[model samples]
Target: MNHEFSVAEVMTTQGGTMCQYTEMTDAARKRVRAMHNWRRSQLALGNVQNGRNNYNCSQAANMYKMKYDCDLEKSALDYAKQCTLTPSVAYNQGENVHVGPLENDKTKAIATVGEKCTHWSTVIRSSEKKGYPGKTVNSTFFQAVKAWWGQIFRNGVNQRMIFLQNLRDKPNAPIAWSQMAWALSTRIGCAVVNCQSNTFTVCRYRQE
Candidate 1:
């Protein structure tokens, strides 16, 4: 059903460029839909790793911008991300995310507070627990991916998740993170919510 309406014919692209956007063009909408088809095909062909798809948002967005010189736009990007994710096998097997560091690098991996912090993705990639809040255990894993994708590149995962969950009537409502859409976009959806909420600010500083 969703695949059919893919990307909502995403209303985020205009004049072959990205902007706050006013109206989406037919060509851009087709491109977005085609992207979904490609991802589904990749999944069908077993082009996945670690029990989930590796084709991530930032990667795709950056590549699109570099290759096309236009913003991939968050709405299109989120659709791309959501279309590709499948739950980890651990989640499917009734296993929770067991979020500890790699045993060799606990400090750099899980220490989000105090002790001279380093990088956010480092901590998140390592510490983000596999288990989710509320009834996510019973919901579709793709929706779970969207809910958490809302956290990537952003601080306050716990806070955001709390807010999102509170907005739900049931566990499923919060899982559809795409419904939030970027408030500043004509139709752009969130990539990682907003730039101010992103880890890039901290992570980039760490690199500097």
Candidate 2:
């Protein structure tokens, strides 16, 4: 389902090339989608390391590859352009937001978002007792990854099992992570909005 957008263009200023995006191009969408699925695949294959003890992580038996949703992108773009540095409370969607130094290059901006996954990818011990201690991560991509992948290992439960518990533990649990790894969630959309001094990279996932 493609939503049409007027041609997105780049403009050159004294500082550098600036992305005056009307919407992300198909290439941008594909890049973001591939980055996410690759991470998910790594986890599902037990290739990810458990930051605690270099332990081999458990594989997800039913992790689904993700698709890009134009609708999700539109919704994410609308909110990202606001540059509020906050999550979208009105839409109640699965979201990850990252604020970084202002980057005018769209490609670099998107790559920076991908880089945040490095922080999101590894799972480690925290101070929490419930096994998965939630930290304050500025509502960024790192936080989402922690919430999604950390708890499964932390609690010594299968990913699918924790997801069921997450459904009942909403508003308290870090739902963003679960949403990212949700077995039934097959779609995602993302946008990178460059404000004057910062860039807001937001990705929204379909909830199942």
Best by TM-score: 2
Judged by lDDT against the true structure, how good is candidate 1?
Answer: 0.23
Residue pairs of candidate 2 with colliding backbone atoms: 148-177
Q: Write the per-residue lDDT of candidate 2 for residues 48-161, one digit (tens) a residue.
A: 654344465577887889888777777777776666654355354566665443222332333333330111111111111121111211122333344455644443333334
Count residue pairs with overlapping backbones in model 2: 1
How big is the positional error of residue 65 in model 1, measured in Å on the Cα after superposition? 25
In Å, residue 57's CA in model 2 sits off its true spot by: 3.0
lDDT of 1 by residue, 1-208 (tens): 0211111212223433444443334444344323333443432343422112244222111111111112333333333223222332211011111111123122232333111111011111111222111111111212223233343333222322233444333333322222122111122111211111111000000000
* lDDT score of residue 34 within candidate 1: 38
Which runs of model 1 end up more than 4 angstroms from their true locations? Answer: 1-22, 51-208
